[model samples]
Target: MTEPLIELKGVSKSFGRHKVLDNVDLTIYRGEALGIIGPSGTGKSTILRVIAGLLSPDEGEIYVQGVRRDGLIEDGGQEVGIGMVFQQAALFDSLTVEENVGFLLYQNSNLPRSRIQDLVKEKLDMVGLPEVGHLYPAELSGGMRKRVSFARAIMSNPDDPTVGPEVLLYDEPTAGLDPIASTVIEDLIRYLQCLHGVCSTYAVVTHQDSTMRRTADRLIFLYEGRVQWQGTVSETYNTENPLIKQFLSGSVQGPIQVAG
Candidate 1:
């Protein structure tokens, strides 16, 4: 089997009086595409945050490349770099697309301005937005903004190739877009995976069925802060599991309770 890139052992997280994750254990292997899916408020996004080291689990351990992480990512000394693409494509409205994509390099790296611009142009082209660098986030369409976020997530400093993300966490990359636009994002996800230096391993937390099917090789179904079912995409369609059936069918008559 491939080496495990990230692992959550007996992880649990809570917000105020509510428990968002309950003794959940999960693993993400190198070079794999994983999907986390479930009803709203089921802690899918929370898991992604925990895995990315953005949120330290209330109780449990996170292992990156077989080494236990001592604190949040900001504490430093992590062997692997993990990047997250938020659901809303959280770009700064004030920054131009070029500035947004290369924000980290511009602020942190000593690279010359011309070099950073060249790198930004390369990433924008990778995401099919070579000319939108001068445009602001407000001017781009929803899908275009999402793509720009992708460019940012994959951006790396040329000085330190290892600084690039080895794994990516995506929160609803296809949400709120038209079907055709969603397809475009899905295709781009697969396309980026095929690139030589781009991230091949990623975890996607999404409620969109089409995105789930096209982007993940393996799926884990979460409910009530726990993983209830796990299987491949084909098994997702063929299994007799009631939770999967109800979710895929969007029916109100099943083990899953309607939110309302």
Candidate 2:
């Protein structure tokens, strides 16, 4: 196996006394699709935040390419390449789709405005939404909004290979879309991975079965703040482990408990 592009050891985090991640250890190899699945509030999104350098774990260490992650809470991106798409698409209401997609370039690049516009156009086209860059978040459907985020996440890297990030992260890429649109998102995920070559690593956090199956070559199941199971997507469907079985089957009678 290729060496891990990103790794977490004994990673743990909490808000006050409420622990969200409990000594979690996981890793992502270069150019592999790793999907994270678990119950709601099971720290799925938190993992993305940490990997994207948005949140700091109280304990444990995070490393990228053998270098420990630092200044995560203050910066949302990297000079190398770590891209993340938030759950809500998180598009700025005040910016056009092109503006939203190219915001990073605007903030950090020395490129001319016209060059940034061209870069945005190419990204939007890559996602099969070539004409919406001029549109607003409010003007697009939920599916469109997700595509916008997806475009933004991958655009910078592909646009200017120098400033583009090497790692990609997704926070529920298919959270609020129809099955058809969800499938499109999944296809885009795979497409982006393939298009980016082997320098990229992806860790997508999602509970949606189809998304998990379609995007993940391997699956990591988190339960009660710990990694309960980890295996290939095919193995997941057949696992006898109660927590995973319960989750795959969507059964309420297993070891998992639902809190009101």
Candidate 3:
């Protein structure tokens, strides 16, 4: 594998009595597409949040580009910029798509509105939504809203190019969408990975089978707060791991205990 971009060593997280991550050790290499897959409530999304620096692990170290992160993202010692695309397409209902996409620039930078708008246009066009900038979040369909969120996630300030996201964390990006909509998001995920000046490395948390197959080159199965299996997409089909078999086949009789 290429040089590691992010590493989680002995990471553990819990909310009260529920442990979401349990001494997990994982690595994300530069330019790799990694998919985190598992049944519901298996801490898939929690891992993404931890990687994105939104949440600090209870008992482990997070090294981004080899520098240990001491606190949450707001504490600001991280070497690389990390962005997150939430599952809910979390856009402001009152703002136009343009405003929503350029929010960071507007709030943090001194760039003029026109300059920010131009940058927003560039990102929107990249996500195949050049003309929807003037529309509200409610005006677009689920897929379109998700694309807008993509544009927002990739939005970067030109004055500080180094601060732009080098790695993106996606949490259930295709969760509520239909199969066709999921495909669109999946295609965009792969497209963004190859697009110049955008995030080339990303970790997507997904339960959708098609999304996992199309967006990720490598797969990690998380169950009961630990990584149960890791392999390529092809290996996922050929492996005899009972957890993987039960997951891929949607069978209730295997080792994976069905949640009541």
**Best model per lDDT:** 1
Q: Tell me which of candidates 2 and 3 scores higher on lDDT.
A: 3
Overall lDDT per candidate, in order of appearance: 0.94, 0.85, 0.93
Off by over 4 Å in 2: 73-80, 157-162, 197-199
State which candidate, 1 or 2, has the greater lDDT: 1
Tens digit per residue, CA lDDT, model 3, 42-136: 89989999998889899999998898889999888676999999999899999999999999999989999999999999999999998998999
- Residue clash pairs of candidate 2: 81-165, 81-166
Error (Å) of candidate 2 at residue 141 is 0.9
Among all windows of 10 consecutive residues in model 1, the one with the lowest summed lDDT is 158-167
The TM-score obtained by model 1 is 0.99
| TM value for model 2 | 0.94
Give the C-alpha miss distance for residue 88 in model 1, angstroms.
0.5
TM-score of model 3 (CA atoms):
0.98
Instruction: Kindly list the per-residue Cα lDDT of model 2 for residues 123-146, writing each as its tens digit.
Output: 898888999987899999998999
